[model samples]
Target: MQSDNPEDQKSTEGMVDYNRNSAAQQQIIDSQAMQIRGLVEKVSNIGTEFRIVDYGCGPGISTINVMRPAIEACRSAHPGEKIAACHADQPGNDWNTLFGLVSGPSGYLNGTENVRTEAAIGSFYKQMAAENSVSLGTCFAASHWFSRALHLYAPNTVWFADLEGEARAEMAAFARQDWLTFLRCRALELHPGGYLLVSTLGSVPDAQEKNGFAASGRGIYRALQVVAREMADEGLINGEILDNFVFSLWFMSEDEARDPLKQDPELSKAFEIDTLKVEPAPLHQADLFADSIGDPVEYARLYTGYVRAFADSTLRKQLFEPSTNSAEDADRLADEFFHRLDGLYRKFLDKYAFEIWHLTVVLRRR
Candidate 1:
């Protein structure tokens, strides 16, 4: 069920060119393609039709890429079974671009017979399809998002890892609840023998790091904080707004991701863990920075675009838009903010890096 609170209704839909700018996310998906295919190959007892749902499938080629291997494996494993590629995301998602890609040259539908596409428009934290219907479910780079926009005050930082004291504890508790809700919803949608593959941003324990933890996107969030503070200092936004601003997402550690399944009797009885692991994710744009001989100008443009793609909508609604009355004022401030962020990236190219990690897990319904 959707939240009634307006703040909670804030959408995390990516910018229009999400596919082009989300190369790092694409890399995470690509790294696990073999594993996805392997799991599908092992799937048995599928009915006359095979249904594979991509939950939180943002608009892009990433979803297409993820579905291809599984589609092929399904075909090889269960010949003559019709295939259904179901894509699920928030209602505000760019469905046009998604469908465009689905019918485009690179889509799984290309030259493939006995296959059809579907769209399930709603939160993945709720049941997306009928019970015992989904054969294989996959969610990539999106499960970290909270079902609602949290109103918690995170005065020190814009990222969860830097949140301190009560803020941190509250965020962790909320994350745990959201994770279990997601698992329960998936349990309802999947068949008894269905397979679920999820890969999202994650964290790891590090004694040398602050809070004794290190997480993906830390540098990016720090850069965001610095740039937002600069804007606030210039009177573009108020101090209170800056202090309260925090991304409504969490990057869970490996143990945090596994705890519920290990501790909850219901989850333990509902599903069996096939694989759970965390690995460092490569930043494709960073590699391009190296190839460009550390060209700050080009690097900054690329990195800023990458960040803006996923974050622009949220920042606009939660920060910039709320700070001003006139739409034009909000637009101007947003443009200026990105401009300054780009300049900061250029000025401190070496200091800011998207050092990200990914948690990949495969679970089978019991």
Candidate 2:
């Protein structure tokens, strides 16, 4: 179900679509595998039962692939130490898909006779785990999502990655609050020597100077706006409704990502920052298709499908339903909107380069 609260949009946006484009996600997960294993081992050395929480686990792809293996390896080394792994997310998450993945023969829990895995569904902003319980907490490509959408301003745009002035400030404030809440919750849940590793979507340095989506190739979001306007002009959707549609996703910069932890003396005193770095994100579309790369038309289909899976629900909510416009009619119009968007992306692909920014941080609970 779609949420009246825009924050749930993160869950409602579709994780299955994200799982389909698992190449880039898997790349990042694999890159961090060694670090995760080290942390798990460090906790296991305490000679106590260990717990791992994959917060906002999505479809559990990363948990099953990267985290489960790391935890299981730690369990094996510790012999009889109990290792419990929890996949946490909002209840609206696609739990069926997650269950299917974790229950199959190839599932993370399948071969690990000594490890136990369970689903813990809830917002991480609250106490998802018992106080001072979790040994290692891993939240990848998930913390950028705020607890609630900043409702102060709605621009004629979809993502906060391309806003300025008061709009940007409002989003920054929300991100800061969300970040603090995230840290506080984790601090309370983590044992004295536990570790917390977080990853998020980010922008390049001086991102604000060139607009927040500087690394994303400005044309990507512009194409979305153009298609929306054209759909309104064609009587497919309400002009007012289309004009009001805005996505709640906010990609904080490196400084913004760190400010909350640095400024809060209490938070800073509780957790020691181990490492914070911004790096180039893996561009799966470009990397995977490099050898067999085709013309703009073919690439557009692949790109749009990847984007559509995540963005279509956000757009669908704004579609008006009048007597003349049934849900079926709206669906058809939505399809047309994406079709035109694909064409626009194809036309602009050659003129601009695609780039993505990523941020990774490691913290130790004091």
Candidate 3:
């Protein structure tokens, strides 16, 4: 299900270390650890073996940060039970970096017994696990990505939030299809009564046009598009390519997320919603960074690194022809873009405020 499109270029270069930069992600994952552990414990009580899949586990940090703790909790609850944890993501992910952490002396899963760790490389939209074989599934901040491109060009915009007319409609369809496809796939992979916990970037309630996580006093995605246009104007990239480039990402509101289940009873019947909540944006990272760093330029650099980590290489592909541009040139242009962006971020540092929302959902198979 992997496509050789611009969107498939999700490499983890220039990415901020998740443990350090992603305070928001860490907070969400940490808040849910006890619940995840309880689910693992429930599965352990029913059988001698338990399996958990960290779907779309980028760089395997979630495996170490979230899943490893849950597995250990299960072990403590059921002394003799066996547990296996699998980290699933696209094949192009930084598995080397992930495994390096796994093999470290103080590895996340170090000193664990009867717990096997594995790497599963593939699309979560497809059947990554055996049918009815998985006891628990966890996909955080990943399912919003579509399995394919939106199939239409986004005019002067990179995210669906800014698109209008047919472009907006096409992206809405894409989001609906991708969300349902993900649910169906997980439905098949999970055993009866197994649990699936998903947390994703969401939109502010009733804030129709403000659907992106903004940084530096403006939408980070909007800033990216602005820089892209400037790159085209300076002849650093082709104008047509810049106009046609889109990020192929969508953030749904709380109500929009519930629409799929409302429309499809058969799909809805497969699982029960344990919790569906939209948390107003958290400013933990903002406060922490301001207190710790206390410098605009360095703070901006850290923010840029965090954003670039998730969006690296994908946007870089638009700047030059694959046939003509050397990898070195593309990388250089990518770095240049971030350099300019970091300066703009410094200028807007005092005006920073978080506007992003998160959809925390929990589902259990029937």
TM-score of each: 0.95, 0.87, 0.87
Expressed as tens digits, the lDDT of each residue in 1-366 for candidate 1 is 223485455558656479779877888888889988888877766765789999999886889988999899988888888999999998888999889988888887889999989999989888998888888999999999998887678877888899889998998999999999999999888888889998998888989877888888777888899989888888897668778778989988889999998998889989999988777765543342444436889888987898888888878877887788877988898788889889988998847777777888899998
**lDDT by residue for model 2 over 1-366, one digit each (tens)?**
224655544434454376775554566687787788777766633435678888988885776875666666676656677778789988777888888888787787776676777888788878899888888888877776667534444446655666667876777777788888999999998998888988765666664554634533334566677777676788776766554455555666677777878899879988888888777765543233333235777767766775676566656654433213467875787678789877876776633233456678889988
> What C-alpha lDDT values do all the predictions have?
0.84, 0.69, 0.70
**Stretches > 4 Å off in candidate 1:** 1-8, 282-290
Which segments of model 2 are wrong by more than 4 Å? 1-13, 44-48, 152-156, 211-219, 282-293, 318-326, 350-353
Residue 146 local lDDT, model 2: 67
Q: Point out the higher-scoring one by TM-score: 1 or 2.
A: 1
Q: Rank the candidates by lDDT, best first.
A: 1, 3, 2
Candidate 2, after superposition: displacement of residue 187 in Å? 1.1
Candidate 1: C-alpha lDDT: 0.84
lDDT (tens digit, per residue) of candidate 3 on 28-92: 67767887888776652243367788987877455577666777776787677677778898877
Clashing pairs in 3: 15-309
As a whole number from 0 to 100, the lDDT of residue 93 in candidate 3 is 69
Model 2 scores a TM of: 0.87
